[model samples]
Target: MNSGRLTNFLIPLLAVLLGVIAGSIVMVISGYDPIAGYSALLYGAFGDSYYIGETIRQMTPYILSGLAVAFAFRTGLFNIGVEGQLIVGWLAAVWVGVAFELPKFIHLPLAILAAALAGALWALIPGFLKARFKVHEVIVTIMMNYIALHVTNAIIRFVLSDKSYKSEEIHESASLRSEFLQSITDYSTLHYGIIIALIAAVIMWFLLEKTTKGYELRAVGFNQHASHYAGMNVSNNIVLAMVISGAFAGVAGAMEGLGTFANISVKAGFTGVGFDGIAVALLGGNNAFGIILSALLFGALKVGALEMPSSAGVPTELVDIVIALIIFFVASSYLIRLLLTRVKKEGK
Candidate 1:
């Protein structure tokens, strides 16, 4: 690899090594077998086909959510409302999925598109305020999150509520379940969503790296004043960025509802997927390919956490501790750079 690419890879690799060493120290202090715990974590994440399927399932949403946050960041926006946008998107997709009786060819795509549009519209509120009134997107997005929560809850009560917290299942025709794949996997929830997520990631990479519109949007993101002076429509780009980010978040919701839950539900609180997206985006270096790998890594950690407490006698919370440490190290990028520079100087 080239020098920059090599450095990027090495940084994350070093951070991961540091995280593991730190986790090991915690395990030792706790009088646990660090070796055993590490082994279990690895096995739990990838020991079998079933576990691999679950990892993919979790990664699917993580990928989209990561993209949601990363997309906004590329445009100089911090979208904290991913959780709310995702929830609303799920509700909208399911609502439309069951409400209509269109053919599968049309209904499936319609449901997905509906969620994307819903998410985009919801995001527009903040975008509009920012563009028109110079309101801070962070504050507006945070407020929009609560608004989305209450609005979705109210809608569930009025429109989709049964005795259960969940809405009625989407029509079979509207569902995105891969019966054939499930049958092969003995009914694991793994579906075609993974493929969809990868496709979306590729498209995002192309959009951001190879398109003129992307150039304009990122130009605005880097320097709105300069972009406007250069005759680019800065306001329009800002709104467009949020809409695109929201659309990705909406797809995350749709994946949950259609591929996993099959309906909207009254969540106990915020889903936290949107918040997780922030970490995922940061860990992935806010790049499309990086986000996919980061999502998978986090997904594996989550899947492994469930088994750690039960099978390895390590508290599941340890996984969080490891993840937090990883993020902490990543956020402190200068540390990695310094370490790399030191290594180079010493070698020379």
Candidate 2:
């Protein structure tokens, strides 16, 4: 890689390292052993087949959600409604899975496609407002999150009047489970969704870097006025970027619905996956390959945090603080650059 790409990557890595150092300081203040806590963390994430499998399984949705946020950010659109899209998509997938009686192959693909469509359509609302009426996507999408939450709950109540909070469990044919994977992972919830996530990541990278359409989209992201002057349909690209971004988030909902949960439950609040995705996107430098590694890192932190309190008597909340610090550092990368530049001058 060139120096520019390498420097772009180094910033995020520095953020991670600094976050860890800050967490270590917190551990010391709290009278805990930071070394042991991190040791437990590493072991919890990779010590056994079960732990590793669960980490991968948890990261499956994370990968898709991260990609969703990254795609929108790269296209210069803020997609705060990934939470809304994910909820709607989850309901759509489960609704199709249980409502239909088709063959396995057809049913499974149909359910997943339903999720993608639901997510895309939900996102289109904000996209339209931004494109046609000059509404800020951030504000509109945040509002839509609440709307989606209530709408999904009301629909669930209307459809499954007996079960007030959730839909029926989906059929086996519509499930994303792979018994072989589960068995290999000591019966963790790992499934074929991980495969789908990997494929999606590859496709996302290819779409952004290799395609003419993607080039147009990036141009619009860089400067809508310039892109319009260049004869690119700036407005359409806005809508299209959100649509593609939401489509990925919708598949994330599919992973949660069909693979992890096997049913859609009524959530009292937003599923935090979408918010976590924001952090993943930032940490990944809004790039596909970076996002894959960032998702894995966050996934490991979450999985490893569970073992911290029990094994080392350290608070799991330390990890949360670390994540927040990482995000803070990343957002303030100018400070890091200034420091680096001063150090280089001193050396010279």
Q: Tens digits of per-residue lDDT for model 2 on 228-333?
A: 9999999999999999999999999999999998898778899888878888888887888888898898788878788888898886677667556655665566
> Which stretches of candidate 2 lie above 4 Å from their native place?
316-319, 326-348
Instruction: Give the top-scoring candidate (lDDT).
Output: 2
lDDT of 1 by residue, 76-195 (tens): 898988888898889889998879989999998899999999899989989988998999999999988988988888888777876557688899788889977677655778877788
Query: What local lDDT score does residue 22 receive in model 1, on the 0 to 100 scale?
Result: 81
| Model 1: lDDT of residue 301 | 77
In candidate 1 the C-alpha lDDT for residue 118 amounts to 89
For model 1 the local lDDT of residue 228 reads: 96
Worst 10 residues of 1 by lDDT: 325-334
- Give the Cα error of residue 64 in candidate 2, in Å: 0.9
Global Cα lDDT for candidate 2: 0.88
CA lDDT for candidate 1: 0.85
